[model samples]
Target: MKFMAKIELSRHIPLVTLIVLVLCITPPIFATKNCDFPAIFSFGASNVDTGGLAAAFRAPPSPYGETYFHRSTGRFSDGRIILDFIARSFRLPYLSPYLNSLGSNFTHGANFASGGSTINIPKSILPNGKLSPFSLQIQYIQFKEFISKTKLIRDQGGVFATLIPKEDYFSKALYIFDIGQNDLTIGFFGNKTIQQVNATVPDIVNNYIENIKNIYNLGARSFWIHGTGPKGCAPVILANFPSAIKDSYGCAKQYNEVSQYFNFKLKEALAELRSNLSSAAITYVDIYTPKYSLFTNPEKYGFELPFVACCGYGGEYNIGVGCGASININGTKIVAGSCKNPSTRIIWDGVHYTEAANEIVFSQILTGVFNDPPISLDRACYRK
Candidate 1:
């Protein structure tokens, strides 16, 4: 049940004017711009989903965006998602959603993250349908670019056609893909043990790697590869398994091990891809340790709540209340609660992070995992 990515109805979307809100916490850090780079295009699941799935789901008032500016902003967070933070950190205007064709901002890029989307298949856990898999999502984007080019060609006739051809839409872009959690979620939620899930993990991951290759072939040079986080600690998972073992930080170690294994293999695959495609810029951003550090050592980060989400109760709650009120393993109601200031806590809903959490995560990306004992992820993306 893949939802269409087309915007047939062109309504005037009331643009909300965002003003500069200076935080008493810290003045916004000016991001060093990569002048040569035009934008950072992100694609993936709920972890980094900006607005790719807004049209996919039915997020109305009350349940979805009760805490938002009186209405849902098409985001799954109380405030901002990871991609928003990333754009701010890079000093680029936030990437728009694939569904939005608001001109003049196309150069900055767009978000293709459909909630519930996995890398291998279109697995949307949202009350919606089958979901838009990473592959189909990419294809949809490619088609959208084609449509955009068609519009450009018709407009320019032959004047600007030669210089700004259809192919150039993607050729001049970078793709950031954050995917692969639902695949694992399916295995666990289904009647499968860790060993059973482990067997298919390689192929599942390879499916995404191949998609990455497909994107590279499509002229995407720069890519941000986001890995998975602990499964057991997620509010939904925690709620289902009351007897689940917990680590020092109360995060389930056994579930984390699964994520650790996948990350290790995926990292190896990415390293090989980098060597194979020397012309490409590939960087792996580990969302685990950075967030884990926050959860494990809240005093260090000065956050109080770690395990339960500030947004929803039950065992889990994302900013959008993803796991909140979600059917328990037994199809029961198990959610309700919201932390006062999502800015202070990390976990937004059960599975995602707060806007504040994303700030810290992006900090790690700009200078932590993605950084080197070096300049940039690859020489190709380095500023001259």
Candidate 2:
């Protein structure tokens, strides 16, 4: 019996070795065969806003879209933003701002993002204020209204109906959220200390989670949420906090810490959401990592002058708080002009990113490396 057992074990050894070899050679499958998201519904602030704020208020003047469209498209960047690249990746048309009714098409998706938007309702503002009136709550309400109104328009059936997306598209579409940076900045610039600003993160994240839940209830199943970028690295923050301690990369240390803390809390909140909304595929994209890398190692990415604004007036960082517009400096009005080559720079207006930088960010985040659950943009709809 012992001799027979030894012979049987030896016979199975080749099978075990073959199994191990197959496992080593073949790549592991992290997600289901790529999901076919029918459309995309986006929400956020300037980082992703196509033209919502411009439609509601005044459009950003010349030099804003000079790189691509050869005219102002209201985007804060010199050319296209990340949303534009994302739409193109899926072979879908650029998202039309919900507020833009003129020459707008919403067959694929709609953008509810507006410049200066916040996750929570901002304090009341005066006329032509910098902060936007469209908070995350307001955007949620608009999305809810959009669903009902579009369904009604499609039911009527006409030339207008052709512009509306089908009813099933809502549940099948990808939902992206890229707001929250303004929430941190508002506190810091409003005379609040770093500690004071950090204290508000929990409430702010709670409000953000509530809105995500609200949208989920309205049939949103796939979510891609971006954490705030490194505001400390931007020229605007560095200029405002000239006295603050700077990191090796020349970014304000305290401000970036605040951003990281917010991301930590936001990630914990999202974990809870995953459990609560079992059917939903929630992806937490770490945009901060790749973005900060651009500043830390700009040469590796074919970028130069990572912290300096490409389109701004005079300053240590080539920014005078104005880009593509005229600003008064020392009693003299000067126009913040574009650089000779925006493709070589990271910062665009001291507040937003350039088209080149935005493209790099999108490319990195589209890979599974920066995403929670390690799912790429094409696999965002699949549950891990």
Candidate 3:
């Protein structure tokens, strides 16, 4: 029997060697498929805010979640932000805001956006004093760093930890950005012409590109950047416009034109980023069109009042003059009210969209949700 075994080994030695070589040289084809490991990072503002600022500010019951929370959760809308809907759609747990202490689980993700936050630091306003800027929010997120090397929270099963060991930044994570609107609004108010705004656009894009790259350096691979909606048609901005006559569609032609230009330029920049940074996956959603559509055809869209919010008094829809709640002015009780059906309307207030509208937008984004498709950090990272 020993002799027979020796003869067999000698005859099949080459075949055995070939099998070993194949196992070492080629990986299983199925292993390279989708990585549904779940997302871990998010960045954006009130549009996607999951009740971040609402907890910090103080106001009467009238100024808060009257339509939903029946009080305030700190979120300045009728109900949830866009981020909440997206997370829910993805089957991930609801996200928690960075500055607050409401949520304990960091395994899923965290929302670093604050209400009244602008991409430009020190450039935001809220009912409760100044708001957090994009730069500041980024700083705040760094502390609770989700990177492997800077792991503030470790996993028992080493799920998130294994992907990004201590100090490793770019594990299986997704970074989102819903910005640029405030920059345009502030620029418009600051005497900057559209041409001037256009001039600054490139620099802003470059800075954002650089910032995203920095996030990539920290280990983020998936990115979702947003475009501005028809800013010219925002209820309050229209009130601010001194010259243009309102088109029945509620679209301020000039303002919409500016938004159009920004989207065009931003599109080009995003395309360039995708092509140049093929290693990182970057996805851009056209929030401008869908959001603008709600305003353009409010009636068709089941919106009874498009120009004014449901939570304000009088026709002007001014929150300070008794909006969000019914305030007592000089002993005279003032009260604002929500619409009959918030689900049908889009704008929650003069400047923001309602939960209903957010759901609508989220559905639209779902059709082409972009991110690192399980691999190729270079293609999905959005950073060169």
Candidate 4:
């Protein structure tokens, strides 16, 4: 009997091995990709702004999109922004701006970013002031409205309503914040001293933390927070400041110092938020280091002119005139033209980064090296 049992076990070994091999080769029907985050909800300023501000202000016209899209898409850059790249990485459709009244489909995501938007509403401004209705606070309100509408349609059993379940979408989607740069820009342009600007860092950090908490209450769990890049390295800043004050890289040193200071404080604030919101996966992305690297080592990034704007006119950095400016050159109308090769430059206009630069910075941001807690977006969204 023992010999017979041994012979039977030996006969089953081949069948078991085949079963194992089949299982290894075939993926589970319900298995999800690591980077398959369900949706994205973006908020901030022009760096990620697709068309929100443009819908209202009619800015970023003509030569602004001459590089890639070959037509104005209301994006501050010549082409796509960082948010577009993030969406593409996850196999998601490009997000539409929330304020895009002309047939916006929110099944994928919505962008609430607007150029010149500030984190907090300025006190001195009246309620009817320009762009006041589209501040970050207003964006949050719009998000609430979107959720309510989506839930209503889903409950009504509409055909496309099932595309996103309200609870699952909010919980699984990544919330991205890329604001603070505009706040700093406003302070500097307002003639605030570096010391005075530093004084406002606490309030700025607090406001951002408070917004995160509010979004947490709304069921958002994953956040990708971007630190301010080297604003002093922007061609606009270089043109505005005296040449004598610029560093060896042609970037204003004091402004960059202020940006670094803000980033430090912001990081600390995010740490405290992580401790407070135990279930939240909040990742702070260091956009400064990678962006500064491109400026300091342009050759490595294939950028020949890291300090110059590819679509501006006048001045050493071609930043004395803004993109799309129409100048009367010898009584003939001459529009500021874009460079022949926008891919070879880091800066796009005087203020924003080229699509190529945004792509590079976003690639670094996803490597887990720039993220706090060292978790990449793929790992953060992975089910296992």
Please give, for residues 1-384, the per-residue lDDT of candidate 2 as tens digits: 999996787677897786787788787775336777778999999999999999998788878987887788889999999999999999999899999989999999899999989998989542456789999999999999999999899889999999988899999999999999999999998999999999999999999999999999999999999999998998999998999899998999999999999999998999889988999999999999999999999999899988889988888998865776787769998778899999999988898998999999999999979778888999998877
Stretches of model 2 off by over 4 angstroms after superposition: 1-32, 126-128, 327-333
* Per-residue lDDT over 1-384 for candidate 3, one digit per residue giving the tens place of the 0 to 100 score: 999986787686797786787788898654554434365466655676665555445432454466666776666577776666666655777666655655445556766666656655654455443455445346335534645333544544455444332333235666777766766676778888777876766766666666666776666666777777888777667777747655678567877877877777777777777776666667776778777777777776677667666566655544334355566769987667666777776667777877777777776665554222222322333242
lDDT of 2: 0.91
Q: Using lDDT as the measure, which candidate wins?
A: 2
**TM-score of each predicted structure versus truth:** 0.75, 0.91, 0.76, 0.87
Give per-candidate clash totals.
12, 0, 29, 0
The numbered model that scores best in TM-score is: 2
> What are the RMSD figures for all models against the true structure?
16.2, 5.3, 7.1, 5.4
Single out the weakest 10-residue window by summed lDDT for candidate 2.
Answer: 122-131
lDDT score for residue 216 of model 2: 97
Judged by lDDT against the true structure, how good is candidate 3?
A: 0.63
Give the per-residue Cα lDDT of candidate 2 at 183. 93
TM-score of 2: 0.91
Model 1 clash tally, residue pairs: 12
Model 4 worst lDDT window (10 residues): 124-133
Candidate numbers sorted by TM-score from highest down: 2, 4, 3, 1
